[model samples]
Target: MSTINCFFNTYQRRLEDLEKKLNRDQLLVADELTSAERELAMEMVHMGLLENIAQRVFVTKQFPINDFLLRQLVLGQGVYTGNTALYLWHLSDAFPYTIQLAVRMGYQVPKQRYLEWTENVQFKQVRQPRLEEDVKKIDVAKTTRKILVYSPERVLVELIKSTETDKELLKAGIQRYLRSPQRNLNQLLMVSKRLKAEKKVQFIMETLL
Candidate 1:
């Protein structure tokens, strides 16, 4: 084989090996790559073999760029809440036009970084005491990653407390939860008590269930 042809074959083999490694995990963390691997990863990014979704985060091109991946990008920054959380719980069929995230008060959101993926992101800052209440890690379908989101009970309480949420969406979410097999009235009431929204929650529960 010619020298140039031999070099090209070796490069293609290296790229294929790297692609297999990234595909197995679905996500590639830049920090985990060695100097040589990092260089190849960047080349892959340029060739459309991978995508640099966030700082130090790259995903294989085969991965879907849906809400799940978007949530993964902001994993440590905040937990998914509001309409977005409702969708995650399968309580609503309508995907939120705006991705709503709840962060602790005074937390600096890297808005520009998130906007690079999608323009419909809203950050809700909550008090320190309430920020982490009832948060849970739920698995994303067809991927190895899990995303942080408010539990169904907590999401219900938030819907009751937030004046910004539409009444129709709130009603729909409540009705869906009431009908779902996973519904837990006890846990719902417990969370309502902690959030000091028991009266409103009870009124809705009484009217619906």
Candidate 2:
């Protein structure tokens, strides 16, 4: 079968799974599903094949999809990462208009193709599995929906690698994260060491604190 045909078939299966499993006529929240289940549901929502009920909240097709729905879909093997994840963790003052996501390197779709399909979201693909503690499911205060996000420590590791290119934004992001109580020194140190950013991480941690 053609790739497009297979893609649509997969989508149809996901839609069927959603209808059979979710069964609710009301707004859907993140707490209701296991991470695996949520991933499946989010793929359909991101594709514009399923309409979301509210910002980051998916409901059945009975509801009309708003433009804002495009910003809320962080689906298909992707996890919120970098500055965007920091923002979701409430460590940054600025709320992003375009969502940033990280997917596994093995993800089938070209990352740029996602932008072509939906301009409100962006994707980055990484090799290897992420540390479990590096990701979390947190509530979206505005819409009462839950979404996946990277921990502050993990976000810092990502930012450190980008410092040469985005120095000002990296400095600002670190400062913002430091100001928040959510910053975990132990985890940050550990992750930084693992990612070979220990020196910079230590400098920022000590200088900022």
Candidate 3:
């Protein structure tokens, strides 16, 4: 091969190796890269081998850009709740238009200094003293990253408390949860009792199941 062809081949190999190293969950943050690796990453971005999702965030072409991944990228400190959590647990067929996140009452959302794209993310403050009551970490599908989210039982209770939620969607979510093989009726009741929604939850269950 000519010297130019040889150089191109070698460069291509290096990029491939770098891609492999950065493909963990198919997501990369600029801060995680060393100076030299940052240069290579930018080159990969230029070549369309990777995409710059935010200021310092890069994702491979295969990255699943869903609510879960977006939550991890932007609101790293909150748990998915409400409709977003319902969708994640497969209790609802409708995908949430905006990502719903729950954070501690006093928590401040991190400022996205480098986010180049706009995401419609809604953050709700969990005013309950025990904010982590039903929170759990779950693996994002097709990625190694585990995201914090409210358990299905907790989500059901939340739906009961929310006055603004769509009635049809709420009914659908409850029905789906009741029919799911993974449904834990005991857990659902426990969460509802703790949240002081036991009566409402029981009524919904009696009406539906």
Candidate 4:
């Protein structure tokens, strides 16, 4: 079955169970209940008029990004990279529907597995010179939760490496970032050298500056 179908089935079952429990005990003691159980109980109690509590039901959005990322984390850890990282950092205004991610080689998660979960995310393998140290946790815009992403320095190198296909758009993106007072030249230089994209990065910055 598709991932969405499976998740919906689980959700429906949980709601049905919650409804049954609420019916049995109007004053449900949630102190020992699971987080989900407690949340459903509260929603039933506070979300509407007292008469509607018995019929209280909630629906979920179609594959919300937050839920998708949480599931991705459960499957295997990953770091957002490329333009996706730039967008999350607020350096780029373009929003991407398909998020780019990199997972460590040791995770044993096949590239094909992400396809089974959702089409909105793409995954790649992070190779040598790109260790876990290169990634850091940061909040995605407007979200309270945090996610792992490549630092700006590593993101610059990744964009440089993609110049073959990305060409002009990336060049413009890099130029815009360089103009920002927040750009860290030293860190960029260090990571570019490690990624073997120092020369390319130097060339790009020189032309823009």
Q: Total clashing residue pairs per candidate?
A: 0, 0, 1, 0
TM-score of candidate 1 relative to the true fold: 0.80
Using all chains and alpha carbons, the TM-scores for the candidates as numbered come to 0.80, 0.59, 0.77, 0.60
Question: Which pairs in model 3 have colliding backbones?
Answer: 55-114
Stretches of candidate 1 above 4 Å error?
1-21, 31-37, 74-76
Q: In order, what lDDT does every prediction score? A: 0.80, 0.64, 0.78, 0.64
1-209, model 2: which lDDT tens digit per residue? 99999988886786676666545433454556657557876776888655544334566565433333333353334677776776666666677677677767665654354444346566676777653447777754334444667777888787876743356666777877777677678888898888888998787777767
lDDT of 3 by residue, 1-209 (tens): 89999988877876776767666568776777677667888887899988876655778888767656554665446788999898888888888888788787987655565232225767688776667788887787766677788999998898898898888999999888878897999999999998899999999999998
Q: Rank the candidates by lDDT, best first.
A: 1, 3, 4, 2
By the TM-score metric, which is better: model 2 or model 3?
3
Order the candidate numbers by TM-score, best to worst.
1, 3, 4, 2
Encode model 4's per-residue lDDT on 22-116: one tens digit a residue.
44433233443567866766665576522221122222222134533453444546788887888776667788677787876655654364444
> lDDT of candidate 4?
0.64
State the number of backbone clashes in model 2: 0
| lDDT of candidate model 1 versus the reference | 0.80
Give the top-scoring candidate (lDDT): 1
lDDT of 1 at 162: 84
Collision pairs in model 1: none
> How far is 178's C-alpha from truth in model 4 (Å)?
1.4
Best candidate according to TM-score: 1
* Residue pairs in clash, model 4: none
